[model samples]
Target chain A: MKKTLAAIALASAMMAFGLPAQAAEPIDPIEPVEVKNPALVELGKMLFFEPRLSRSGFISCNSCHNLATGGVDNLVTSIGDRWAQGPINSPTVLNSFGQIAQFWDGRAKTLAEQAAGPIANPLEMASTHEMAVKVISSIPGYGEYFKKAFGDSKVDIQRITDAMAEFERTLVTPNARFDKWLKGDKDALTAQELKGYNLFKSSGCTICHNGAQVGGQSFQKMGLVRPYQTTNTAEGVKAVSGRDQDRMSFKTPMLRNVELTYPYFHDGAVWTLEEAVAIMGDVQLGRRYMKEELADISAFLKTLTGDQPKIEYPVLPPSGPETPKFNPWAPAAK
Target chain B: MKKTLAAIALASAMMAFGLPAQAAEPIDPIEPVEVKNPALVELGKMLFFEPRLSRSGFISCNSCHNLATGGVDNLVTSIGDRWAQGPINSPTVLNSFGQIAQFWDGRAKTLAEQAAGPIANPLEMASTHEMAVKVISSIPGYGEYFKKAFGDSKVDIQRITDAMAEFERTLVTPNARFDKWLKGDKDALTAQELKGYNLFKSSGCTICHNGAQVGGQSFQKMGLVRPYQTTNTAEGVKAVSGRDQDRMSFKTPMLRNVELTYPYFHDGAVWTLEEAVAIMGDVQLGRRYMKEELADISAFLKTLTGDQPKIEYPVLPPSGPETPKFNPWAPAAK
Candidate 1:
């Protein structure tokens, strides 16, 4: 009995460290990815918090990707221009730097492209590129900052996109329990969670969900192994790329903070992480997880959450003589 | 010339009193509408600012309708539910009580309906009605308050909606330069603005834009006289209501803070208020205005802005055992 207990403890410890209880391939340590431009990231942080970039003169990027939360407003879809329903689910920006593409349809190839899309998207920033330039240029401090940041006082789309992308890149989730376990923490997971992790790998989830980003490196057919009904599939890449086969294929999302970023799935169909895990297993993995397995998997997935990145508000530039308190309806002095 | 000036002064003074400046009949003032329960409004205010209502355990209504900037985020659309675009513009909650209906599509018939929409919206609060009740009820202070407000500790949807609606009703835009002039402040508007106001009425803008809310009481074809092409028109309305007549017909929109609400129109096609006014005259009113007239009208519209409403955050209730800081992905204890 003493020898059996010792063996069980050894197996448990090994499993907690992301090692197989029996002999198997050892997992590698996750390398910390460094952000390229700290200054641009700092600048982007300020810009993200600045409401002046919006037409309403009140909303900032933080309004949606609220830092205090899991970097998402927990709504089915966001409200925007004229209080209409946005076409897609808002993805968390926490581990977005790991994403190969941005947006549900993956219309943007780079973070810079993604950054510019929202600033000029009528439903998002509601400001035209010309208006954004004009608004930024009107602020003397911003003009100077632009010159210092991008070698020009002339505010343009490229600098704005670069700055925002730089800021977003810094929004990485910190070391999660899973990462700690991978780094050899022997108490990071439990026996049941270890079983769930094994199931996750054997179930073929690792086929698409392997990488530092976990799942953002590629696109896959959501219902490849099984059939699932989705309205978005009908309106797929045709609406964006005007192509076929791109049909039913979406950018695989990063699962870094998946526990907090719900309702899950592209259309926000699954509200609970357990339901999502179960559905993905059934529909994508071609198997149905048992109740115990589902619960354990959910517990394991929860270990993926990490500390949120801290962001500071930007100091607004002095309003030009033409601007009045930045009030949209303030009557121009006759 | 003296007699002509006297007549002009008399006409301007009449206009100040919310009366028509020209031959149009004077319209009645929209009566002050009363909320169903004033105490509920007080409660709603508390709930609105409390981050505990959110799934991630942070973010309140004030997170978007920031009181510091005219009760709007100033973004064309707010980010929510994982940083996705909110479908419509975040209309300033200021003076929203005067709106005939809530939301750009007139989806919510009352403030209560509007209040409930966001809380349940997957992208906004990402909470269900039951979840909201459970969370609120878990708070001891909220239980007592709900009992006091609704005669029950078991808070229901109606009570929550009523409280929020009551709070929203109090968010009226106070006196602005326009209001002061209406109260007989002779110098409230300049000569150019007065001319612009005259043009505003004479050009028949008063036909659709006349009301306490300035324009919320009606919905008219975007281009009544001349057809204006908008890429988002057909699909936009279709997304909200499947009705065909609803095509190109959006909420007339309140022009109270027109100057602050930028990238004008439903699709945010017009970048500036001046351009919007110009387009309205050409397409809706079927008349053309000179650059000078557009400038003056734009100036007159500015006077409609009022002081920002004061908002106080509520003290959190301490009843429920503080759920360990909502770490959705934290590993379970061994």
Candidate 2:
């Protein structure tokens, strides 16, 4: 009885400290997939930096997916269409290629398809594919680059889409401290970070963010154990699926670089990783974490941030002979 | 005329390389205000740690205002009662005391008043002030400490509110590199940061965020120039003030420690600081910023983040002989 009590106490201590139990096996690390079309990726980078594609002639993909501050723009939702608030959260492009689908609604099937949606969405880029093609084709430099990248100077909408998509593919975050630890470099993470990782898995975050991408494979309701009823308009899959059950069922976003992405969840509701984790335990898993454990989990999440890729804004595209007149979107130019 | 053009060219070249044309005037830096009552701050820190304050007895202020990643809980909006989404964006508490008012709507008159609102609001803490007082009174250690701090053995709602407010006041962020530069430490910021600062002032951000707090004194319409009309019901100040002129007039929030706060603005609308600055120029100021200028501004904003404060979570209060029942809307709670 004494020995059993001692063992139980030890286990309890481990749980309090957020350590994994001795019985569980360690997870094996998976290698990242090599990206194809490096040159296309380079072209995509130029396109991401170009604001001419936007109807406002002021925004671009990098406008929201900033490389300097993680991969996310750090806002809960992106301001687009003359500073109109977007309905859903903007997930980071970092490691997003590993996601099964794109967008909070999972409406787009691939990165290329996803690129097209935002460009044409009334609230986002507010530009049609044809308009985007026309804008890019009109730029002499872009025309030459398109021919070099796609082996055709046709400068069609599909090639532009392909180049932007290819650029997003190369925006993957690589080898975070956690990734290094998973690859058998035990010293990569602090003891607290490791403990947080264990608690993250045992507490059931792994249920959604388990794969190599850490998430982005499925859709889950915001509230699992308890019903999350809000007067806020139904978002996520419900907008696309039109099913009652799909209400508040947002895409399971990738957790890579999550520590850098403030205001977590579909609505950007949660503010800290610790708070989000604690709330998840209560609403999703029906459990509560000790303060120390929550702290550990937060520390672990910070290790996911990798170095931001360096990007240079492309030279402004010169107005072409056949370029559409720059009609000011505002009522009257000052 | 030739000499003037030559000077202009030189200045333009310097700006392109991310440098300022002139040295900045030095200014004295203000020290952070210290909390009045240490014991009360200590007690409030404990309350912040204790999840029992929530309706579910599983969430706390630390759940959202996590110290690890600035002060935000990192969700776009916080999850509260039954995991309901909060209406407004979560601002960082790092230098929140510098603000003119609390909440995005500027509804609360003081931090003490703001502290009580969340505890009883159905969508947030959901705990009545009476219940909160009773719970604290029941704790022996807390009861004793309350008497020492307020000269009463029993814990009243005002004392509870005051204690929490006192604790929150101590959450001041340390001075940033920008502050150091303003104090005449020339090497405090990089050349890019200095250029960004120039663009920030010339681009009209200084029109609102001037003075020591950077902002927090007024409210402004989001689309002052462009008039961003949207059918969405979340039209900021209009929802609070119910006046036509108040449409989308959100409180001018402080820019202190802004780089740490993601999802800028009251609605958490713009994601990156650069994107936010870009939108401010295009929609609010009726101007556009060059790409290099925007980059420089973003670099300068990063200098606003201060060193993290040193804080420790409080201990749980001990149980007492008598306990009062929960009452959310009591005058004392107010």
Candidate 3:
């Protein structure tokens, strides 16, 4: 029994710490997200860009996770309803489906649940689920599309979130230059990038940032070796789990498009890759990165940029008479 | 001498009030806006969609004059910075280049001049030209695009507005069903729509509304036959011309995509096309439209819906370290 328990612990550790050190592959290239329903995807695309979902009739999911700028809005944190500051950085929605769970704390297990987070957040879309359903129902063109996407004649929040997830599933960015290198194309990576990859492997970044998404596979402490001081009060899993053991631990974010997803990390305090790498070396891995190492690593990051999806703007339906008037700035009347 | 004077006065009146009694070709179809420079148009597209030009870095020309929704936000008036109400309804940007002059009051003589209006207006973008220029110059990606568009290394408001105008020049939507009819497609209009067209022509609606854009060729009194009731405080061209005669006189709006550009007229008080057509009959001409006549006119207007421009949303450059943090929600420092 003692020998069997020992074998089980070792197996679990190997899976948790990634494949054995000398294993052939360390990280895998991200694959494109599968879209089974094109009609559902189309409806989701319109809903994703529909600003009328917000109480302000202006903010949308695209406002934060903007696909035009590498599926991230490229802000330290997102500005939301009534100009409210977001609690944390907006992650790239490009390969979000590959994440073990959604959100920094892994609170939501699926993209559908994650999407519903912003729609009703007072600081975000500032709209209730009920209002969102009502508003969409009022728009004449949206009703038929919803019915076509889902068999439901009456639109609901569950259908709205599911369609949004279905559309986002198709937003995966494939064929980055680094991905080409990962598939055994020797000429794909520059000398600096290869050197950076070597340093990254030896210095232990791949321990957390591995697999298809290059990091979103598991949860780990943000500052294991040293405390990371930031004004951002997000305690990560502690807020969700209500346990001291889970404090300061967050779901590792994907780094496929790290070049464009700047202002790195959960706190979003660092602006450049060089600075972020240096801080990560000190706080997470307990290694001091030299200036040359930072430069090489940043060069490697740039190669991750893929072809941004060229989306033709959807011609939104004209507002119906029953639609609520845009009045975010007006004083609430008694 | 008396006969000659009488002939001269009659000719002047005919020219001012459109072709007299037996006017041929009363209301021509709108022509497409000409594009001279590809590079300038590309840069202008980025600038037109650049929300960073606004004080809040959230609203762009596309916010109000949305390409995704028939060039109009479809609101009674625009909601500006901090939710301030706009003084008038936003005009359609599509086919607007065909207007005799820009704005309802003919305040800006050219599209380039008109482009500069909203950037500085407190109720609009709420950003001064100096700040706009400074912000654009600060972004490294925008600086290079400007240089590529215009051979100037140093960016300024004039060059910015000029490039934007060049881009707006390409926004014309041609080939409406009405335009096809104009080009001698005899079967273009349905029986009801054709009757509405005949009524529109024979009922003196074309007296001021004659031209390529259907109405943008001249200024006309809002209520020539009866006093028009609207709570909107816009004094029309009188505010610009400082002439009592110009009071309640506005440059007639184009009707190319009237179906999508709803809540008709300058005040934008009316919602349904039927009611708007009825109001025009009572106020513009000394006649009242029957319910069926209003329905027919509304149906005919829907035929004016043109092929909308398919625009790929531009991938905006990431903000530099020097870029201002989005903090409209934060309290001003004491």
Tell me, by TM-score, which candidate is best: 3
What Cα-based lDDT does every candidate model obtain?
Answer: 0.65, 0.67, 0.80
Compute the DockQ of candidate 1: 0.04
> Chain A of candidate 2: what's the TM-score?
0.87
Pick the lDDT winner: 3
Which 10 successive residues of model 3 chain A have the least lDDT summed? A1-10
Interface RMSD of 2: 17.8
Write one digit per residue (lDDT tens) for candidate 1, span A1-334: 2332454566568768966532442222234458665666666776776666765554456655655446665445554443335556667777787677887777888888887776666566555667666777776657666666666776777787788778777777767877777766758878766666666666677678767777877877777778767664334444577777666677787777777777667776666777888889888888878787788777777777776664433434434544423343333334
lDDT string, candidate 1, B221-259, tens digits: 777788887655334344468887776776777877666
* Per-residue lDDT over A129-234 for candidate 3, one digit per residue giving the tens place of the 0 to 100 score: 9899989888888877877887656788988899889888877767888888776576888988867776776678989989878899999999999988888889
* Residue B133 CA displacement from its true place in model 3, Å: 2.8
TM-score of each: 0.53, 0.48, 0.86
lDDT tens digits by residue: candidate 2, B234-292: 66667778888887887787777676566666666555777888887788888787787
In model 1, which runs have C-alpha deviations exceeding 4 angstroms? A1-37, A237-241, A323-334, B1-61, B64-334
Candidate 1 docking class: incorrect
TM-score of chain A of each: 0.85, 0.87, 0.91
lDDT of 3 by residue, B1-334 (tens): 2332454456448657865322445666666666667878988888888878887766789888988778987778887876678899899988787788999898998889999999999889888899888888887778778777877657899988998898888887778887777766757979778667666766677787667677788888899899899999899999999999999999998887888787678898888888888988899897887887788778878788887887888877767667765544445335
